[model samples]
Structure formats: C-alpha cells, structure tokens
Target: MIRHRDIWRALDTLAERSGLSTSGLARKAGLDATAFNRSKRLTGDGTPRWPSTESLAKVLNATGVSMAEFVALMGEGNAQALGQRIPVIGYAQAGESGYFDDAGMPVGTGWDEVLFPAIGDPNAYALEITGDSMAPAYRDGTVIVVAPNQDIRRHDRVVAKTVEGEVMAKELNRRSARRVELVSINRDHDDRVLAPEELAWMARIVWASQ
Candidate 1:
C-alpha cells in the first residue's frame, strides 16, 4: 500500500541523503534531468503520475541505496535514516578559542546542532556560513558538514585553520610534506600556498546544504 506521495518523498529523501538536488539525483542515475521534478509528478490532465519501478531501481543503484532502505525512507523507518546530529557553529566563529581542538575537530561548548543523514564520523561537525565570502559555491546561511577524520585529497573542498587562528574554506590543489596549495572558493581571492607548519589542521567538507 505505498502511496504516490510516499514514493515521491522517498526520492526527495534519497537526494538529500546524497547531498544533491532532485535534478542532480536524476543526472546521477542517468535519467532525464526532470525525471524526479514536481512538474513531472502530475500529468497534463492533472492526474497523479507515479514513478516507474525501473527509474526507482536505477536511482537506488546510483546512490548505493538498497531497496529496503528506499522503502524505509517512505515509512516510519525514515527516522533511522536522518537522526544523526552534529555540532554546529558559525563559520566566522570557527577561529575563536574553545570551538575546535588542536586537530581541528570541533570541541568545547556553545555549539548548536543540526540533523543530517548518518555520516558515520563522530568527529564530524557543521559550519553555518555567515557571509557572501564563499558565494556561488556556498552562499550565506548554507550549512556544510565537515569530516575531520576523512582523508583530505586533491581537489576536495576543505576547512582549514592556521596556527595563527584564521579559518578558511578553500579547495585543495596540492599537498606535500612542506606546503599545501589551495584555491579560494570566491574567484576574487587569489590562490595561495602555505607551509604545512603554518596550518594547525585541515578537514574535508563532506556535505553541504545548498
């Protein structure tokens, strides 16, 4: 007895779990960009249109979600999928004392909380963007989830803190024993490289609410 609305909502949940929009999810599944769009959910005659089983199966495969998990998202089991909470702080306050540890993991008090799909990292946290400094890519008020223990790789967006207590969100270009090269998220800023000794720590940004 799966309702049409339930199926649609399950798709929305899957998109959110993967940090993507409905169109993005459709593209990832190799379907038409409007496959999961609301306009396509109703016929021209105003009749409710249901998603095909084939499309659902393809989405599940592309997102690495099992059919059981998709069904769970449509039912009371949805709670189990989105209940993980992480400490949150304003990006502007990230450099303040008592907000982070030496390793750049969030610690201490004054942190708010935000619920997200399970990221499986106890050291994960969220940062609320406060200004247009990271515009276009991450606008003001966007919530980005950071994974401190995740491996930082080339071309990944990251939150980095320097030993002098400045926090920056940039894209990693290269990293070596001596220095790390980073490209600014905002095009107005110039690319820079800093000695490894100048940075306190760095963490990968895993997800962002855009």
Candidate 2:
C-alpha cells in the first residue's frame, strides 16, 4: 500500500540520488523551486497534496530516470528501510531539554530525521552542525551520526554532553575511569579534560553526512 510518507521519502531519495536538494531538483526539472518542499506537501487546509503526474514526469525526464527506476526509488524507503534512519537535530539544539534521555538516547519530539547508509547502534541519532566552531573538520550544516551506546576509544570523534547542559563534538584523546581527555575538532578551540561525574553522557561519533 502506498502511504503518504512513502511518497515524500521517495522524493527525498530521488533528490539525493540525483545529488540535489528538493528545491534544486524542482528547479532542474523546470518546476517551481518549492514544488516538492515539505511545506508544500500539504494544503493550507491540511489536506495532502500528492505530486502531480506531470511534475513527476518532468523530474524523471530531467534526471534521466526511467519509470521503473522511479518505482524502485519509491520502494527503497518503505517502513523496513527506516531501520537506518536516525533522529537528527542541530548542534545548538542538542543541549535542549526533552530532546534526550538520561543515557543520551533521542527521546522527545520535533527531531529532523535523515536516512543513513549504516549506523552501528539502533538508538543512534544525528546532529547537524550549525556554526564555524567545528570548521576544518566539519563545516556548517554537516550532519554527524552519533551512537550513544558505542564504546569510546582513543582518536574517535565523539559527542559529549554535560550535566550543565553543554554538548560538544571533539576527538577522544584518552579515557580513564575518572576523566575523559579530548582534542578539539578546530585547533582554535582548546582541548578538554572532563570528569566523568560531571557528564550526563558521552558517545562516539560513528558517521558523518559529508
């Protein structure tokens, strides 16, 4: 059965396969740049606005995708495929309340989501970089996949959240029973030595959407 979310995910997947954003895809197809935007997916009265066949055909032709290829893309992100999706949020919002549980698992609502090829932990979530602080290694808007249940090791990129509500991304230098030593992702930022007792949770950064 075709569901509302399936069509949206298929559109997003199509855009990804073509190396374009949804707006870019629409523009490339000679449609309004917002044609496939999430905001345009529903009417003002809240009815779903299914993509018109004409628009679909235009996009398919523009991307050189056959009907069969489009159908295949539609099937690629069904419920079974969401096993690889992780709830994502901006780094600025990572420290906000109700977004994470005590163990740092994603818990609350309003999470922007993404489909990744692979994630080591089922409970893993993603963080979108929002500033220049993590430059050189990670640029603004970069999406990083983090696994809260994974073991932290030396040289592994990590996401650490503190009890005072600070969340940071850095490289693991060393971890002992008491404290964790970390190197800054940007050299301009100083290194850190965090006491484990002061941390809410710390986890390994497993993948990135570069």
Candidate number of the best lDDT: 1
Query: Which parts of model 2 are misplaced by more than 4 Å?
Result: 1-83, 118-120
Clashing pairs in 1: none
Which 10 consecutive positions of candidate 2 have the poorest summed lDDT? 76-85
lDDT of 2: 0.80
- lDDT against the true structure, per candidate, is 0.83, 0.80
Q: Residue 151: error of model 1 in Å?
A: 0.7
lDDT of 1 at 165: 87
**Residue-pair clashes, model 1:** 0
Tens-digit lDDT track for model 1 on 1-210?
456887899899899989999999999999999999999999999999998756875787688775447767886955455456688888878988778888887877657776555667888998988888888888887778899999988999999999898888999999999989999999987777999999999999987665
lDDT of 2 at 47: 94
